[model samples]
Target: MSTPALTLQGLGKSFGDVRALHDVDVTVESGTVHCVLGENGAGKSTLCNLVFGGYRPDAGRMLLGGNEFHPDSPAAAMAAGVAMVHQHFSLVTTMTVAENLLLTQHGLRMRRRDLTDRLDEIAQRYRLRVDLDQRVATMPVGARQKVEIVKALLREPSLILLDEPTGVLDPAEIDALIDTCRAVAADGTAVVLVTHKLGEVARVADAATVLRRGTVAGGGRMSKTSIAELLTAMVGRTAADLDPTVAATLGLDTAGPRAAARQRHSTALDATAPVLSVEGLCAERADGSTALAQARLAVRPGEIVGIAGVEGNGQSELVAILAGSASATGGTVTLDGTDITAARPATRTELGLGVVPEDRHRDGMVAGMTIAENLFLGQLGRFRRFGLLDRRAIGRAAQAELDRFDVRASGPWVRMGSLSGGNQQKVVLARELSATNLRCLVAAQPTRGLDIGAVDFVLTQLRRAATEGCGVLVVSSEVPELLALCDRVFVAYRGALTGPVETADLTAAQQISELMMGVAA
Candidate 1:
């Protein structure tokens, strides 16, 4: 048999005192798609980073094509026929797509024509059609992802690694990406897909490995194992015992929690008084072009509503207006009959409206700050006494929240950036849900990049909020996420809002997708 594309004997790495990865072993054969599955912070990224020479292994070794391989840097890894597409991209947004790819070929000093030819060749081969002249900053998340994939393929490496590649894609984009993975493997390149999406793992991978806290937990050939089994391995249990949200995500039965939640709180919500409402909302982009148009919606007390669409279909603009961080050129937004269209974020928070931002790191928390400081960001007045910040009081409250939210951290002193994606999300949820006067909540992509367990926690928290008489409005690209959590779902397309179809309605899903694609009924 031909030599395996990559073989890790006893790979290990550490970050200061934390054992990020232990003695781990995996083998990836050429001409096959191998999936590396794990929960966030379970060392999946660390292993891929080590393999791509983003970090040197603290112990053990790796082999590529039956040759001893220990790359000291990313460049060395590329030179040794290994390429990686990081979960968070490293491209320079100001540059054009062509420029970004050219940066990768700097050492080779290929002529402009040669670069174009190579890009065309790879693009055609993988069906990854991206506008080479388009500025990276202007492209959508899915396009940026395709650019990253193309950049890796341009290297023509024997092995390629992708970290959570589908986290930003819509269903159609995901299908196309999976096809590319198969094509790459068919050409004899080993493709290591590092992700927590067990469904995708089952759909695309030939073999799989599961990691939990830096060690192999369980895995097998894709044909031999099931998504349910891989999920059980990742989170340490069967689907039956998992939260309803988790079960719904895994395509297992949860008996429609949305309907159950409404039924449970029907008496309280019978008045059908909208806790949050928008009427003919119109918004503009920074360049003064229309971003949202004539949008209208309502969320009654104890109700969970959803907005679903492809990315960049005015979802961000709608979210910004709802979050009280952007202006609407016209129309009104009301919270319990109070007009708050021109309200500031702080004012909205104090007026009983909590918002979980789209990009948590950018909008919600300060990564460099301590958890205590981040937790009390908007409500610091609660601890300010006689012109002095009450550190001791903040610490106690932050610790209490940590415990309540089950946020795994080293007390409240740890930097917000140090937590995993899941934990950071938990902290965001804690900050918003802890308010004494939380009447309505607006969350954007609530479970976007979270793992199964984290997803379960976040959804449960939202349900609990609804259970306690708070209205919820969630914006997400995943249809499954919306169907699983919302009592009613809407579609946002070309800045127009359509449908508040009941998720429980027999043909609701078909209608939602049709509306999402701008279909008129």
Candidate 2:
């Protein structure tokens, strides 16, 4: 028989008494994507870690090209044709793209120019464009992730694993990565993708495996299985029970219960004066490139307005400037008629401006801290008694908020990083929305990596915020999300802004697609 790319037989793993995975079996063939699906603690990571040599299995064996295979470390695994790109990056912050890629292989010496040319060639073959001279620290999170994928592809591994790759990327970049994966798989490599997005699986995966509570639940060939069947297997719930918008995203027939619920809570919008407004707002990237130019928009009380565009087209810079992480070179931004263009983040917060950053872990909260501590960061005074923080008070309130947000965690004492992406986002939202004085919110890619349930909950929370008269400005890479949730949307392209176009008027999907790609009205 011809050898398969990889095969696992009855894999099992345990940490003390906690069985992370058991009797998990999967086979990957040459030139195909095999997706792993599950909720946060479904042993997807355990399986990926075992394959990449981050952990050793307590039971079962692996065969690589029909031969027994075992590796002691990640480096060893890479040497044996198993390459992995982690959800978090591993590139040096101070290095340039070329410098980082050149360091991929150790003890191999070559002229810098020659190696760069070869790297460029590989990147071109995959159609991934990287700014060779750009420093890692200066690039956006999405750009950095692209570089990591390219680094993994450069190794020419027979098996490649990508963990939650699309979380930080825009739609265009995600599409490009999917294309790249197909190209590599066509070259006879096996691709294992661990993802929460079913739509993406529909787009890229040839076959799938669903993990539930450390065991294989169900999965099948994409050509043979329906999306409804896949969703039911992964989540163990009927589509009718899901939020309308969530169901819509999964290509299911959707109802309007979520929207109807929001409507029940909503008061009439006061559009005479905006709670947040921007006029001719201009900003520059860290490298002095124009990031935003002549931007104009407004969010009325009890309204959610969104900005949609391809990544790297001023969205990040606009959010950064508004959040007070970066300075605007020109123009003005006002929160409730009070100019805040020069306000610090803390000052903005004090002025009732809450922000949910684009990359939640990196900018929204400290991962190493407990959820309670993270929730009250810079506001310990609320729970302070006699100049000491009241731990019991904080824990009680934090737990209540977590429960309200449907955050699945042991308790408020758990480390923020220990929670899944969706749960982390819930915690972030809990902190920001709980503020008694919150007047406006700026959410950047708020639902970036969450599962369907989490996305529904978060969007519901956003609607609830609007219902309570908190003006909202959402910056997103997905046009459909904006169209579904926002009252209106603005299209950004090449750092230029256009719109305030009502989603109701923008009925055709192609019209919005054209606008997103910078087509003239």
Q: Which candidate is the best by TM-score?
A: 1
lDDT of 2 by residue, 418-460 (tens): 8878889999999999999899999999988777778888999
lDDT of each residue in 408-435, candidate 1, tens digit only: 8989989999999899999999999999
Question: Number of clashes in model 2?
Answer: 0
- Write down the TM-score of every candidate: 0.96, 0.92
Clashes of each: 0, 0
Clashing pairs in 2: none
Best by lDDT: 1
Using alpha carbons, what is the TM-score of model 1? Answer: 0.96
Regions of candidate 2 where Cα sits further than 4 Å from its true position: 107-117, 120-124, 129-131, 251-270, 506-508
